[model samples]
Target: MKKQALSLLLALSLMSVPALAKENSADNFVRGKTYAGQFSDLPEGHTFYENVAALYEYGLSVGQADGTYGLTAPMTVGQAVIFAGRIRSLYRTGDPEAGPAAFTAAAIGLKDAQRVYAPYLWYLQAEGVLDKALDEQLANVATRAQMAHVLANLLPETVLPPVNDSLITQAYASRRRITDVTEYTPYYNDILKLYRCGISVGSDETGSFLPDSPITRGAAAAMLTRMVDPSLRLTPDWHLPELYSAEGAAYEDLVTAGTYIAAPETAADYDQAVRYMLSQGENTLSLKYDQDFTVSSAQEALNNALLAVKRHCEQGYNNASCSYNAAGTMILKFSSIAGDRTEEYRSETLSAAIAVHDALWQQGTITPASTQREIAWAYYQWIAANCTYDDAGDNTSVSHLPYSLFHNGKAVCDGYTGAYNLLLKLEGIDCYALPNATHIWTVATLDGETVHIDATWGDQGNTGTKQYFAMTPEQSYSLHPWPKENELPQ
Candidate 1:
């Protein structure tokens, strides 16, 4: 209905990308081996978000904050560069119409180019993205992979593939002179990060970064190979191996990280995999569905309390009433673990709580609106829910672990905080979770005001208006922003 909510809904809808006929993953990607999770500014999602949130926070692919990423949007070279400087090495700056060339991040920030770049700020100058003279004007409008391709060009021709038509267009598109290109009105933090990192240089004589245009399979292959190849990235020259055979790696010199044979073979195999996955409907597609759980390190905290309920239930196995209360309570306690960085497991736990609550509601026991607090219930459920002194999951992985309401659950404080923090983020509500007297709760900003959200009390169910607190905007601002992630930096 509202513009923001409408935008949020649209973003949420893009998460589902239909499988493009499966293929042999062996040739394309190594599950845990080939891909490097943590890159540039993003510490890997650690499987915390299946499709959206994982990439969003890391600044790779952002979500609607209402829990949506335009996952299916056919990526354009210009739009893709947003993650260029941060996720990959690359830079683009300069006058779109002068002598264009690439430059390292540091080189472009010369005293003369402080507010603007020179003609040859080449990091991401797509060869023909725009008219040479006007290219420099379109800086900062490229995408991650687009910039990567531009930088890859700096390497010897043998190591780097030819630039694509789309990238060329994107380079030109971004260079359009802004009507009010005043000094100090622009922020090139993203571009600067890439340039300084030596990931890419500026454009050719007419400095520009084409930020529009559709990429082609050939160019995509070249760019993808270079990014994955460790050798190509390590080297700063451009040299493609002599074109010898019809197949095999004609572009091997430009790639260092991959052992991939070629795109045709890989794409074909991928198609097959997609077909197989499709045959099984969407269930087998791991990307399409979430994983179920066992009593892993994740459940160790809540299972202790569930164990008691388990034992009691054994005697009166099918008693619906006992089953509902015991399981429901455990589910609430389990909520503490909602932010386990494992959404699959968290979703499972939430589903259980909802199931129990739904049954109770059907019997006219719990109020309908009361379910609003289920999100909160999941928080404390995982935290203090029957947790023994030290549980494996929280002790080893998470910190500031919260004790459940009645020793009926287990969750490290990290999980609790993450759950609350992410929930607000997913809902597009700006909020921060805080720690006080060994307990955790969140402060949210909405309608120009701050609101306190205490999951512990919220999950406990309510009498009237019980645990939810609303703070004056100023009071809420006192709560610190969410903490950043820890990365094994490069």
Candidate 2:
């Protein structure tokens, strides 16, 4: 095997401390190996031919009748199951360091049964890894994301570490292509786990996981190799900075934007610049600089700060993008709402703010003597009672915005959070919009700690209890996990 130069420190930090049963010095699992083979199509220089050959040598696969490895063919779910069994057998025979464990029966059913792959399918079913119903076309091609799900689940229980142990899910979730994965998908976390486990680093440089794309035969072999080999993948080079710190945030911007900037005259100046940009809200900002203010660093810092501030202003539905020109002028544009931030939207938002304040005040839900819990609970109940959930308007219009809740008296999660958060801020409560994998919710500081307050889930047709309101991290994480747990209060 050829030596693959990579760093593991960052990789280790991104994942949980893996408990490998024993250290195997065998190079079978290591990457960068080459082999001459009978396969006619997979040439020596083909992208993943080495992996395909490795799997073949390991007895995980047999070449086609034509002696060609279908490197670009879409892998079938049944074939994936067979691969899992072959891999388990390889570990059992070659390593000899670990003992076999019992497999639990799967809870879900499988439809079509190919006799050749039946034993492997039954093994996966007993392991509980194949716990969901499969389609009738057992030979149908599987998607790249589906492959991720199956491969991640097939990881040896002993080799697998706890999921999201490094709290990197939020960082992974920020990639531009994540929107490609539909909301509430079954394999959502499994796909993410594939990256965290060092089995895959996504499809491209932009962190485009491209989960729905079909898995190629060669790609499947490479993925299978990486799944068992801990040292085969590269560490993620980027992460979100300490959002509350100006210097940290500035550094993050510089890294992501890949732009150089002249440092501020002093650290104090940089801090002031960041704080000021955040306070500017949704306006085009112009920053004048002294003759010595080259602002090479602050330029990128300013852009990053604007992004964070925009998140706060829009309650985490951050659609605002900003950039600085050579003239030192900073422009902020919100393309998501575009013309929708018209006179109509602003007037309705303002009216909703006033209405929420008046109602809460009149009801005595928030007062100098009221506890944060009481204040938050009252607001959650108020929104639940006043607004009916608009399931169809989820992503159609501005129905998720604050104005929709007041005007239409209907909303999705975003509107429930936006309206409630605005009301809390009016009464001087510190609240923030929190991000789940594909959804958003509200969190607030109350009674010396932060608590989750999801009005959308709490509103159970006006007859439901406030069970979801004021939930602790433990209570809400399973359903609405805050990817950045440390940022939220313990």
Candidate 3:
């Protein structure tokens, strides 16, 4: 047999601890020897094969007499204590068989069948690894939480260093780390200690550690191997999906545009109701009114809401219709431009929008101190330079929303106007979408003056010229007609 080199700490501790246990002990313990036998069940490609092999290689486990590893068998509390004792003994003395002889089965008051675990339990208790209060539960099956408690302190922090502690702390602060494990949970700190040490990554993407669930032998083997081998540790992939922050100026824009509704009384209320429906990635909304409304008024409100949805909301809907009943419930339906939106699809779209917004902000060199006019010009130039006029005469759904301008790099009049309006609102600048019979553009309050900007025309031949930037009403009307009612001062 080849002699394996031990750490200096273990070599030093060997002089203080007692001699190895009897050679005929039930554990059949061996030191400085690697296991050569293979389990019939743990073949190559098995998920637990590598960890179980590591377990055998370190003399932590020898499987069953039947020559098969009971991978799915529930790990008992006694077995957990035994594994913890073995790990501690190996780390402290370089041999799993050595422990203090002052502790024994009779000394711990173990009477009958539980006496089999007495040596390991007494060793752990003597070494401060096992609390005396946990002695009664040694006969039952161990839960994941119990397993964490048993294994958490088996090795010191020097050996089991916390690698993912910061990430875990952040996720826990956000309440996104583990859904089931809370501060009130038993042994919660112990479980988190294991997680920080990379011994266990929760069972799911959400980091859901079903603490009360029984742990199987295969799972135990995986955690046990990671306890000693830092290379086998896993980093958790538990990041939450990003969504538009309610604290951002964009959310205030949504609120101001009447996208969030509590009641449907005023025009803004109805508009916000429709906007809310569209933002939810849904095509239908049933708005219940608190006050009585005439059929024409309800129809007019629906039209206004639809217009607001088209202008303010980034989602694209091709067509819409509404029906009002005597009961004051208006059922509004819309045909989405992007068909069949799932939660995942919505998350992906929002993520893309955020990415585009961040990239544009960085590349445009727009700062908080930048004048509204300068910011507006930056947006105008970036859009004109990057996006092309969608020459396709057919009204595609994307062409009606900013998604076309930012994602596809091409859009018609409304897409350009919508993108501009949204970007201005996100910067806390006041802006509006101005639409004529066949054209749409932007009117913004810049430098205490109202200015007309047409990015679509500015990007003629994909050239971002300043042909229509900072134009007064008089200057813009010659090229694009402005409605008298929606007119603004120069």
Candidate 4:
């Protein structure tokens, strides 16, 4: 079947040679004249019109003889190699037509069926721009991945510098860059190099490269133009809809609040302000008091504000410090539990965590008839079954926050306690996170009795156990030491 298709493709290529030659003849090859507008199919409003115009103006492409650009036509590997070879030649020499004076398929040891593209194949292979493995697939329609391999090394980094390298690196680290491309994909590094050079963004908003899909003429034109003209390359501003919509009624109100606080007088006001900032994924905030205060009074206010933040905000704020500026305004700087993550990354992580929380809530079998103890046990089991302990011991990880447990499925005692407390609060059960010198656990009021639930310890290998659920203070303290008296609620 493949042989039949290749034979048909070769016959078609042979039949189209006369038309292609006429289109590329000296009579039609006018320097600096845009041939893209001449094509009846490619209008100014077309998405690839500018790129095709650039391709034509640079003599890299000439449209079909039928006055159409064949925008959606699948580009063959032969055409791709020819385009790549032309681009290399044009970049090296002032003229696009500059290449080996004479070459043939027989001369390069290629099959006679590839005679139409033999010169281009020989030129590209001699220049080290084309891989010899592609010789067998010259008649096949080039996939996007194959096109990337063909065009990647046409120009050196001097002309095609990787402008979006850091953004691509970050996107890959988060596993959100290209949906279809992975480390195991063929020519994976070449595909990424195209993105870093801004030669291609992707076929969709999610940055899906569609590696198996055939490349279209318009898409090929866009990529070819970008290779020669750096200005035409794209800088990906990844629009992650899933992350944005993951907030899902969990923190919508808090995330939508204003960041500025006009007059924060009481501890409650300060607490609300801090919550607003954290919800908006801010790491720094300036709180100006309506009245003046001495250094000692400001220090007290800062201490109170920190306490309020710790009590009301639990979005993985590890620590915070405040300083009084010359104008007596208090500037607070917070260190996030998701260390070194950008504000956008932190916001997305929080949204993803909220999505997990909402999903678990919807999946739970909780009802009005369910007892408080049963509800607590259900949450404890769910946390234990779903999340594993973070044994990596990375201090900068988000293991200290609920996000690690909800999104990453691995966290420390602090993450387990935070997540458990969050779910219990959603069930209208009063719960608080109790922290000791080294570990943290949840203290919840179940059936009019206060009991400790340590999900971290409850998670024993494959599934969660009730060994630490609904334990008395004596039982819990036997395995895990009790928190300081000052840290415990009266």
- Candidate number of the best lDDT: 4
How does each model score on TM-score? 0.20, 0.43, 0.48, 0.47
| Candidate models: Cα lDDT each | 0.31, 0.56, 0.67, 0.68
Off by over 4 Å in 1: 1-344, 356-360, 363-395, 398-408, 418-440, 444-450, 456-468, 476-490
User: When superposed on Cα atoms, how far off is each prediction in RMSD?
Assistant: 27.4, 21.1, 13.2, 19.7
Stretches of candidate 4 above 4 Å error?
A: 1-31, 100-102, 105-113, 239-490
How far residue 80's Cα lies from its native spot in candidate 3, in Å, is 0.3
Best by TM-score: 3
Off by over 4 Å in 2: 1-34, 92-113, 135-137, 161-167, 173-179, 239-490
Error of 3 at 421 (Å): 15
Q: Which is the winner by TM-score between candidate 1 and candidate 2? A: 2
lDDT of 1 by residue, 144-196 (tens): 33444444333333323333322322232233212121223222332222233
Could you give candidate 2's per-residue lDDT for residues 1-490 as a string of tens digits?
0111012111101111123322322333332323567578887788786667766544445555446667887778767766765455334434211112222123123222354345555666665666655534446788877787677777554575544334345443333334455456658787777766766666655456777777887888888766666545445544433211122111112111211223333433433443344344323334444334335644554544433333343332335455555554544444335255544574557566666665565454554356778877777777777888887884556766776787788877777777777776655567766755566677777878978777888888764366888888788887766556323222
lDDT-based ranking, best first? Answer: 4, 3, 2, 1
Which residue pairs show backbone clashes in model 3?
A: 258-272
- Candidate 2: 10-residue stretch with minimal lDDT: 8-17
lDDT-better candidate, 2 vs 3? 3
